[model samples]
Target: MKKLFSCILCLSLMVCIPVYAQDVDYSDEDYWYATCSKVQTSQEGVKACVGFQNYLDDQFNKLKEEMESYKNDLGSLQLNSSRIEELAKKQKTLSDSLDSQVKNMENQIVEINKEIEAVKVEIEEKQKEIDKWSDQISTRMINEQAGTGTNILIDLIMGSSSLNEMFRRFSGIERITASDQEQIEQLSDLKKELELKKDEQERLSDQIEEQKERIEEEKAFAQELQASYDQLAEEYRKVEADLKQKLQEQAAASNNIPSAGVISPSVEVTVPSVSGFINPVPGAYRSAGTWAYPGGGMHLGEDMAASIGTPVIAPADGVIIYASNPAPTNGGYLGNWTGWPYGGGNTIEMLCNVNGTLYAISFAHLAQEGFGVSAGQVVSQGQYLAAVGNSGNSSGAHCHIEVINLGSMSMETAISRFAASADFAFGAGWNTTATACEAGASAPCRERPERFF
Candidate 1:
């Protein structure tokens, strides 16, 4: 029993100490879950945690590579939604993968703990047998064929001081029954098994800790992207509002000429049934601004309010110039324009020909995932483009529609340079600060929907 205990101690010591790698593994699962960065929590007495910057950087880069692959697949800046779906999938995978792997690790840990306890109990029962037949186990071990000399037990016989002592030791070996020898061998097996369980537990615990860090960092970078996206949206809202004010002035010169206290709609009483251009939001009514707001804010687009899922169709045959579909349909506030094209939210812009001239028709505050068309896709007049949503700096559910006539630019050149810069204003001179779109200005002027729709 003393020898058995000695061997077990040696095995435990081997598990407890290693020559290299000062890192330690978790003994409890809570230790891994409760902490994200031990290095960051150094002053609070935490250890075995990951380094904040290096570990996070590695994970951030890996996920960025995965997201960038989707972006590259999309092939153009007009397809800003390319990375959003991939980011969502990656986030979901991170969650599911961590849950499954951690559950597996937990099950392994529980079984290993049970294994360790069982081994301890087995050793205890063996120790009890030693107490039951103390005299027999106290006798020296021996090799049945001393001449074969396989085991260290022969040392006892060879190291005897005298002929009488050697025979006496042989007699001692006779008292060591087969049962006692079997118990020693069983204990040896138990020691090896225990060491393996310990090592495996240590390894699994380390993997779980590393996995926790990786997942945490990935989520951190995603949140960082959200913050940056929101900040950019806020900044662009200022510019969008400013440019819109300037565009409003272009039409204000003609519009300011006459208005009773009540601004009247001049929509043609004779609605054409089989015309080239049609009303984009067919079932919706103007809720607020039309050409210009009632109080005359720089309303560049007409606001057509409708139910949340109201379909907004293309007014004429057109090619989709740009589209973004990342924001939530009902997640808009007064100043929240958080997506591509800055403050436009989930927007879609198409280049169409109306009245023998190219027109860039923009539909803003569109539904997020509810859009049926993608950027660069072609559609006929009255085709389903997207559903209306209260996104961006909007207060209610509606679609803000803007139309700019592109003079004589070819379809290829016009589509290529639609959103060339922040000052794009849908097309070329639509909002050029110097170009006044007063009553009779050229083709690049803002066209009124009430006058033509």
Candidate 2:
């Protein structure tokens, strides 16, 4: 369970899927290839090259900013011990951002691969042309040194009998000599041009290779940061209440928080209810684990992943305890913590009675202005709640649902308790020891929603 929780926390990195790799015309491979291959050639190609390099520079600059931000985040938390989990989350977010930049660089390498290969072929052809020109020049020089053309000219001049014929022969010989010299000059110029192209190709290819190596190094660094973070923290070390407070603080720091009790328009959708509870997201199949498996991640709730605007409904008969829309539906980004409890965008906290047992259920990352019900509202099983949103700390559109067993706790008691202290997941989620609900345990126990679903 600890390992699973770790994996879940890592998902926080993926929450803000992309801080956009800019979409510019210059990002094309031809432009990237021209950036180097035409260094000594056309002005237009040089411009294109500059644009491509500038694109790369911009991405790298963004990465640098993220790194700086990470440093600042760490510095702020250095004096605080209770906020280690938050610090760890910040570290992971920055690490993921860095890793994402590295991938962008690698993608550039891939995009320019064809162009680079074509340049290599051009270099080889230029070298061949240079070789041919050199061979022609060498032959001409050797002939001149041996007086081969000079003897021909002399023979032609001496063999002429009539003065008119002799003049004609001299004219022909002069013409032939001038033509040979002109050919050599032209070939020499061509050879220099080919050599320039070859040099440019070599230079640019080397630069590209260096860029690739640097990206690999950056990738390694991101991995190292992830490893260090994993050791420093294990998902959530603090209690749910503390974590909730931290999220609230983070939102407050922004100063642009969405006010609570913001009612949304009514939504019409069918919800699938089986016995006491219904699928919160009718068509979306929910993940039933604490965190993502196969690789390390951290997730506290069952995620019902779907496209934006997908209807989110109540899992069972419940009363809305607390509801708020704090962030926009499309406002989610990496490292953003705006929301009621840090990334729990447009949250709806409710305590429901499934059969005879009381359970506290929460829905997070809901669409903006899509709240069909509000605080203290009486909602039935499979009632329209909200829509899936790509809200705070979300990688995509999904509703994160958490269910607490609440043992024998009364619905009224659970609601009042939560109202007093906005502790999510019914008192800090699963225990580090046992996953299943302990038999004869006290009321207000956290239960795995997967079992109920």
- The clash numbers for all candidates, in the given order, read 0, 14
Backbone clashes in model 1? 0
lDDT of the structure predicted as candidate 1? 0.55
What lDDT would candidate 2 get against the real structure?
0.60
Q: Give me the runs in candidate 2 sitting further than 4 Å from their true place.
A: 1-97, 124-193, 231-236, 243-273, 276-336, 346-361, 365-399, 404-447
Tens-digit lDDT track for model 2 on 1-453? 224323533443232211222454754554454444344454344344545666766766776676666656655654244465456556656665665656655665664565667767877787787668656655654455354333444556576567876666566545545646665556555555555555555556765686787787677667666665544433332343345555555545665344455222232222222357767787887643553321334455677778889988777876777788868886654345567666676788776776667777888888987678787677878778888886775545677887767766765566556655555655543323233364334555555566766
Worst 10 residues of 1 by lDDT: 260-269
Prediction 2 TM-score vs. true? 0.50
lDDT of candidate 1 over 240-260, digit per residue (tens): 455544534543444431121
Clashing pairs in 1: none
Evaluate residue 351 in candidate 1 and report its C-alpha lDDT on the 0 to 100 scale: 75
